[model samples]
Every structure is written in C-alpha cells, then in structure tokens.
Target: MNKKIINAMLVLGMTAGLAAGTCTSAFAEEAETEEARGYRFTWVNPIVGLEYWSIAEEGMAAADAKYGTDTQTVGPTEINVDEMVKQIDAAVAAQVDGIITMALDPTALGPAIQRAVDAGIPVVCIDTDAPDSARSYYAGTSNYDAGFQAGQTMAEMTDGKAKVGILMGGINASNMVSRVEGFKAALEEYQDMEIIVTEDTNADLLIGTQKAQAMMQTYPEMTAIFGTSSTDAQAAGKVAEEMGITDQYCIIGFDDMEDTLNYIREGVVDATTVQKPYEMGYLGVELLVQTIEGNGPEEQVIDTGVTMVTADNVDSYKE
Candidate 1:
C-alpha cells in the first residue's frame, strides 16, 4: 500500500458521497411535488337542491378548478340532520385531507365534527356554524347582523310604526334563530311596531304561503311582514299579491333568490338582505386549504359581508 495509492482512494470516496447526496435531494423534491398535487377536500352541506346551496356549490367548483384540489360536495336532499351526520361520518372514514360543512344542528353534529378534528382532519364551517364543535374557523355572514340589517330596513319602510308578522325557515337552525333574535333586537327600539305573529314554514315555499296567509288572518291589520329566509320572504309577497293586498303590506326578507328579487322589483317586498353564499363557499375551501398547508387565517370567524337590496339595487341582482 503506497502513500499515492491511499490518496487516490480517499478522493474517490469523497466523489461517491457527493453523488449519493445529490440523488437523495432529488428524490426528496419529487416526493414534495407529488404531495402538493395529491391533497383532497370534501364539502358537506346540510341540504342540497336549494338555489342558495347551488350558488355555494358553484363557488366550491370555482375553487376546485383554480386550486387543483380534488373537492366534492355531499348533502341531504332535504333538511335531515341524521343524513348529514352520516355523510360526515363517511368522510371521516375515508380519511379526507380536510372537511367543510354547514352544521345544521350544532349540538347534534358536534360529536361527529369533533371526531374528524381529533383524527387530524381540519374542519371549517360555512353558512351555518357549529361553534361548540372543534372547528378551526368559520366562513360566512353573521346571521345576527344580517337580521339586524333586515330589521333596520323594515323600520324605515314602515316609518317605525306598524303591526308586523314574522316568517322563518327551519326554526331550529342556529342561523335562523340568530337572525330572528337580531331582528327582534332591532325592533326593540320601535315601540309602536308590534310583532303580532311569528311562524316557521319548514323551508317550504307552499307552506310559507299558507303560514303568511294565516298570519295575515291572525293579525288582520298587520301592516308589514318580515321573512327570515328567501322562501319565507317570497311567500309573504306572493300571498299579499294573491289576497290583493300587496299594496298594503310592507314585506322584507333575506337572500337574493330570483323570486325574492322579483318581489322587490314589483314593490311587493320593500327590501331584502342578501348574503354572500358564494364567498362562503369559495373562502371555505381557501381557508381549509390554508389550514392544511399550515398557512391559515388568525381569525376564528370570517365575515363575508351582507348587502341590503331594494328596488334601487334589485335590477342589478336580477339574473
């Protein structure tokens, strides 16, 4: 073993170590790229087939297309909490990367949502929130504030004094309950504007019509009606028109449904509060992706904002 032979062997050993290190680095980079492209997410809504939920679904699709996320939506055909719970449990069993859901019944859905969270799946609530659950964030308009906005508009339409009836959808829904509470809070200042009747329509347009008519009959001199949901609001207007008293009742409602907009244009509804369900659907995906990637928002609740639409702005929303 000569000294020159030993030096040549040491040089060869150094070269082999460098080549192995470069190969390892390339493999690590490839693995990272694959992980980036493979993230999957699922969105769960309380119920499907509603125009509002359809809009939210559109937003989810937009986000999926833009971000290259493998996203899907699951929901019940009707407002059934048990069905929604089953959908969520299935998502958890499948081990999705993340979940976005509208908690129709916070208390009932809390345990299921918590299980997802405990399993290391990030959860975000859109539209209706399960605040008591282990959700990481909320992306939607404040129901209470939206209701307050509706109430304020109602006060202006009736000149702060009128006999009013209330119509609502899915009375047990947390969002609807908050909206009703906020509406009542707003009217507390208007002593003369009495709320004569309040009823739930089970989110059915036809039922809303019957309830609205019943309210009118119960409060024969009712000067205004406030609907906490789109169907409820539109029904009040339709009932007034059918009863040939559209000119007499001041109707206000929520959401920007086509029929609701028509009611506004025809002056049957004085105004309606519009929510950004599109934003909720879009941002829900964005935030969940962020959380999964460790870049989520610091805030717990994200307000998507609300708009009050009357005849003045009704034309813009018509299509």
Candidate 2:
C-alpha cells in the first residue's frame, strides 16, 4: 500500500473503534438510568397526628414500596388550611414527581393547587377535594353517602324522637356541610326528631369539647350528639364522659380514630361512620403513578365506601 493510504486507513479504523465504544457506554448508561431512578411522590394531609391520617399514610407507604418510589407524607399538626397550602407550595418547590393533598378548604387551596399543576406537577386530592382546583383526581369516600348513613344510624339509635346537637369543624368545609345536611334531611323525615343546637369549633378539640359541654347544659333533654369531624367526635365523647352523661346521651361520631373506637367500646359513643382513609391514600398514589405513565383511568372521582362501626362491630375494625 502507498504510505499516505496506509496512514489514512489506520486513522479511520481508530475513529470507528472509538465511536463504537462510546455507543456501547451510552447504551449501558441509558439502561442503568431506567433501573436506578424511580418516580418520587409526595402526600400532604390536613393533619398528620390523627390516627385516621396515619392509616392513609400507611396506604401511601405501601404504594411507595410497590412502585419503588420515594414517598413522603407532610401536613399540619392541626387542621390549618394556611399550613396545608404552605406544605403544598413546598412540595412544588421540591419538584416532586407528583403530589397528593387533602383539601380542607376547597377555596383557599385552589390557587396553590393550580400553581403546582401549572408547574407540571401532577396533583391529586385525597379525602377532601378542591373541585375548582387543577387537581387531576379525587380519591375519597362519598361524603354525602357517608353522611346520609350517619343520619339514618343516628335516627334509628335515637328512635327518631330524640333532640340532637351538632359539633362540626366548619360550615364552609364541603365534607362537614354534606354530613350536616344529610343528617338534617334524614332527621326531617321523622317529625319527632329535632336538631336544636349546631356549633362550629373551628377544628379545635378543646373548643369542640367546650361547645359540647355548653350544648349539653343548654339542651338538658338532648338525646344524641353528632360530630361531623374526627376531632369533634373526640370532643363530644370526652365531654359526655366528663359530664357523666354517657349513659343518658347517645354520641355518634365520624371517623374511626383510636379514641373514637375506645369510646364506642366503652359505650360512650353509640356509633361512628368509618371512612376508608387508608384506601383513599393508597388509591391516590396508585392513580398518580398511572396518570404519570399515561395509563390511569379518566374517572375524576373515586368513592371509597364507608362502614358504620358500633360496639357490636368494633371487634371487626381491630387492626
């Protein structure tokens, strides 16, 4: 071969070998990238200290393990809409792959939720929903149905002739409002039943207890006390216990928190509606994952059924 042709041929061979090596390395890196990094999901509840919220956290953790993703649960110590909005904002700032939240105040959280959605983060509302917000899905119990059930149960327990009092978180919350309305509507069917006192404790357990105490004193013939929220239920139960009226009054509460269950077992609470909070949390994460992968269902609302738990059925709820 001529010297110039030999030199050119050698350079071409070396260049081809280097290109081949680079291609192999790139392919290996791509494969590893897919295997190493999974999706990251964040869940924000209205309150983290509550047992019902912990059940939701449990479901979220299960989903995280199944999907091999980093999942986190953060929320306010109490039901503070402002704190929840701040947490949502921080989740967006952290650039999580997806966010799931419980919208305590549908109106107040709408803008923050929209901001997260606008930032390209998939947002799902669990437990409570912000219908006007940019949330992709809502996974929770049918609040109206749950409330209706509560109403029916309360009516039966009170024999449709008892005077009732209501303890609620807020009138503005759709979930609380739905329960109150359903209870009222059901009670109206029975002409003998009357709801004389309704009070909003603003999500304060102490305030709820105080309100319940006042109502108990004001309506000396109050037959039953219904709590629309978990904290309110706890307050009513505590007040009944303190006033030595557990035997005389019927207490029906919402949510099957530990204390609530104990009250039922002790006969302080006649019954409570047990919402599937853990299922809500689990389904929310699962839906977010499917949506991110473009395989989720188009359904906007997911109804996790509710159960009525009383001392008779409290054994079934253990663990």
Candidate 3:
C-alpha cells in the first residue's frame, strides 16, 4: 500500500494511547547521534536474549557494517505485549528514524506502529507478521507455508498415519496460529493423521517439557509431535529421552536454534523448519533504511524463506 493510504488509515482510527510509552534515554541518545553519524533504526523483539534474536542481531550488525546504519536491539525480558507496545512508543518519542519489529500482537502493537508511522518512522516486521499493523514491509518466513512443510515432512516420516500433538510457545502469536492452521490443512490429506492436542507453553521450555510429557501421558497413542515454537521440539525431545522412547515418535520442531540443530544432529528431532533470522535482520534494516530515505522498498513482503533441516544437512547449521 502507498504511504498516503496507510497514513489515511492511521488518521482514521488513531489509537488513544498515543503517548503512553516511556521513551528511555538510550533511544533518545541514538536519536541525538543520528545526524552526526548515520540513520538510526531500532530492532525490537517480543522476547530478548534468545539465540534466534542473537543470530538476527548478527545480521543487523552485518547490515550496520555495510550500510553504516546505527541500529539498536531492545525488547522486554519476557513475552509481554505491553512492553512491546511501549518500546514502539518509546522509539517514536525518541524520534528514531525507523523501526524493525515483529508484530507480537497486532491488536496492541498495531496502534503503536501506526503512531510511529504517523510520526514518520518507517516500520518493518520480521520473523513474524501482523498484517493488520502499519508495518511497511515484512522480512521473514511465510509462517503458514513453513507449518505446511512441517506437516508434510511429518506425514512422510510417519507414512501418512499418526496421532499428533502440537506444542506452541504462545497460543496467541499470529505466526504460531498460521503454522497451526497450515499444519492442520496439510494433515487433512492424511485421514489417519490427527492433531489430538494443542499445548501452550507460555514460551517456557520447562513448561513446554511438562506439557509435552503430560500430552504424551494423556495420549499414550500419540505417534507424532509438532512444535510450533523454537524450543518446543527440544522440550518434547527431552521428555521422549526421559521416557526412553527416542526415535519411537515423529517429532517436528521449529527454527534452527542451536539445541534444535543439535537435536537434529543427534537424531532426536526428526526434522525442523529453519527460518533465515540473519536475512530477516539484514533485509529488515535494508528495507527500513530504504523506506526512510524514500528510495522505495519496491516490495512490502520479503520472505527470507524457510528450510527443513534433518541429519542430512544438520552439519552445516550445527554452528
């Protein structure tokens, strides 16, 4: 969509919490240094200190090294929508030139994003999306497609027949929802493939493990496990190890986090879908800078794409 259209939309239902988020001094400092050095962009995440985000920061650093953009990564210590919204608000208050963030919750994050747009800062969504938000571009996996792929892989591994369980970090995340939908759709082709349960781990591996164990105990006939979160598969795998049932059930995980990859290498996880975190960071910065300069992104959605990893290709992603 054009800037005029988006701006008009923002003006129509501008959120009431226009100035609620506190803009911290760190954001202010980056804004202050912009003119003296280079364009400043903030990369905000729903949860910080994850290996996934760290890898993404590597891409951000690469973009910074190449484009000379001053980028900072910040987010809540946990998966809190309020903090995500506040960070965007903070960015706007600091007058940051651009924003790169995942649409953790559109209902909340969307308005904050619209406010940032109203303030003239370009916003880009990465790793996940909130199509309802005011983000100008998205650089990440086609989450639904990734899920469909996982489903197909599981079906093949299980010979198109298995009782399945789904593990999700959070139930409300749009990306996870998309994955679940796509996974279900794919499994429809196999009448014997059933998703018997959906567990919400609240992004905690321990909870995920407990949930996985509970699901397994509650549904002992379950023959497959599908994890929609980065560490869900690992959690399930740990449970399988404890139960002395490794390689007995088909386990599909998400992302290429180190442990997930290690699981693949060790033949614990049957397969995993890997999203390009680095490219999301690299291209997010690229798109944000391009939008800020008015040079044009020329495209709004950039699918950094997904890859399925197994022992066959696990060696390359082990690091």
Candidate 4:
C-alpha cells in the first residue's frame, strides 16, 4: 500500500476508537444518573361519609390524575385523635413522598407530624391545622372567619337581642375552638346577644341532638343556636325541628352538609358558612406536588375561605 493511504487508514481507525470510547462513557454516566422519579402521597381526613370530605376526595383524585402520582386516603372513622396518629405513623413507615392531614387535635398530632418531617418526608395540613406541628403548609378555610360570619348571621337573624346557645363537635379540635372563639367575639359586639350555653357533643349527631334538646329545656328563652361542626349543625337543626321550635329559633351552622342545606331549604337552619373543601383538597395536593418537585414555598398557609349560605342563596349552591 502507498504510505499516504496507509497513514490515512491508521488515523481513521484511531478516530473510530476515540468515538467508541466517548459513546461508552456517555452511556455509563446516564446509567449511573438514573433515579426513581415518581411520588407517593397520603391524604388523611378526620372521617369519611361527610359531604365535605367527599368533596375533598374529588379534588384529591383530580390532582392525582393531573400529576401522574399515586395517592392514598386514610383516616379515623370517627375523628379519633389516636387513630389519626396511628395512620400518620403508618404513612411515615411506608415512606410516602408527602402527607396531607386534617388535625382533629393539633397538639396531639404534633409529635407524629414532626416525626414525618424528621424522616425527610414533606407534610401539609388541610381542612384543619396544627400550627405548632412540623407541617410544611396548611391549606384550608379560616375557621375563625367562618365562625365570625356565623355569629354575625345569627345576630342578624335574631334581631341582635337573642339569647344564644352553641353546639360544638369537640373542644380538642383546634378548628372548632377557633370557630367558637370567633363566634363568641362576634356575638359580643351585640349588647343584647348572649351565649347562654356551650356544649360539646364529641361530634356525634345523636349526642348533639340530646345536648341541644337538654339545653333548650334548660334555657327556655334561647332564641338562636350556633353549630360549629357539620354533625352538630345537623343535630341542632333536627332537634329544633323535632321540638317544634324550628321557626321560633334561628339556627346558624358551619360547613355545608346536605342535611344542613335541606334544613336551610325548610327554614330550620337560618344560615351556614360554607368552606371550599374541594378547593382545600385540590390546593393541598397541588402544593404537595410542587413541594415534591422542589418548586413550592418552604412554608405556606392557604386560606380556602368561607362564605355564608342561607335561604337567600341556597338555590345557587345546590349543585
């Protein structure tokens, strides 16, 4: 072979070998950098079967579809604080990518939430909040604001001079406590309005009914009643209807439940403050997805907000 041709052939062989080495190195780097990039999330609510929770579930499902992530929902059947704590611990053990919880007892669940945080899992609270907990964010209604609105509506319905009673789900629940405080503060603005009794039903509809009935018997002059939770509201309305005082006593309630809406339509409940549960759930998941993707705020508290729903606008909220 000619020297020129021989030299060109040798150079081509060397060039091909270099290119092959570069390709192999690039492949090895890509293999080394491969990572599991999907996420698993958990949504914990106080209970199921309530309309509010179903709405939240819808929002959560929507998020799961949108983000192509696996999501699970679990919680206590009766808003039991211990049960909720167990669920949280289980989710942490499973090493979920994120957690969304509704705290029935803020202090009780703080440690468990902190444990999840310490484990490097992101936690977001929804529907209820544990401000002192290790949750990265809160997405839900402003309970205090809802309660204040309920109080103002109650005062107006009672002509500002009514003796009032309050029915609460549980005192341990921070959301309910904030609501009661806001209601009381708003009622205090009316010189003639007074909260003569406050009772806890443990979030049982039947117990709420019994306590409300007993309160009515004890306070015959009561002209209005406020229910700080869905179960309490339904019980208060049912009790009033059963006692033939539905028309005489103005009932103000919190959270939009089907029963509450029905009572509003029948004039049993004068008004209720409706929180956007679906939005709360949707935003909670959206925030969680952002956090998992490293695109969310370090700490955020989103107020889904509340609005007064009464007979005047009950039809508008029907669907």
Report lDDT per candidate.
0.77, 0.76, 0.78, 0.77
**Worst 10-residue lDDT window, candidate 3:** 16-25
What is the C-alpha lDDT profile of model 3 across 1-319, one tens digit per residue?
5321122112212111100112111211222222323888988877898777777776676667667788998898678989988889999999999999988677778888999999999899887876777788877778888899999999999999999999988899888889999899899999989888899987778899999999989998998999998889999988998888986789998887777777777878889888767656766776787787778545566665577888887765423
User: What TM-score should be assigned to candidate 4?
Assistant: 0.85
Task: Give the runs in model 1 whose Cα sits over 4 Å from its true position.
Answer: 1-36, 317-319
Candidate whose lDDT is highest: 3
lDDT of 2 by residue, 214-266 (tens): 99888898888889888787898898898787888888888877788888999
What are the per-residue Cα lDDT tens digits for candidate 4 across 1-319?
A: 1111112112212211011112111111222312334679988778866667877776666556566666788886677889889999999999999999997888899999999999988898887878777787777777887788888888887779998888988876899999998899898889999889999987878889999999989999988888888877789889888888887788888777788888999988888888766666656776787787788643366665676889988876533
Q: Between the candidate structures 1 and 3, which one is better when assessed by TM-score?
A: 3
- Let me know the TM-score candidate 1 reaches against the reference structure: 0.86
lDDT of 1 by residue, 1-319 (tens): 1111112113212211001112111111222222334568888877677888777776665566556677788888777888888888899999999999998789988998999999899898987777778988787768888898888888988889988888988889888999988888999999987888889887779899999999887788899888887688889999889889998898888888888887888888888888767656766776788898787655667766577889987765422
Please state the error at residue 261 of candidate 2 in Å.
1.7
lDDT, residue 266, model 4: 95
TM-score winner between 1 and 4, please give it. 1
Give candidate 3's root-mean-square deviation (CA, Å): 9.3
**In candidate 4, how many clashes are counted?**
0
Candidate 2 overall Cα lDDT vs. reference?
Answer: 0.76
Candidate 3: which stretches are off by over 4 Å?
1-37, 317-319
Find the candidate with the highest TM-score and give its number: 3
| Candidate 1 lowest-lDDT run of ten | 16-25
lDDT value, residue 289 of candidate 3: 74
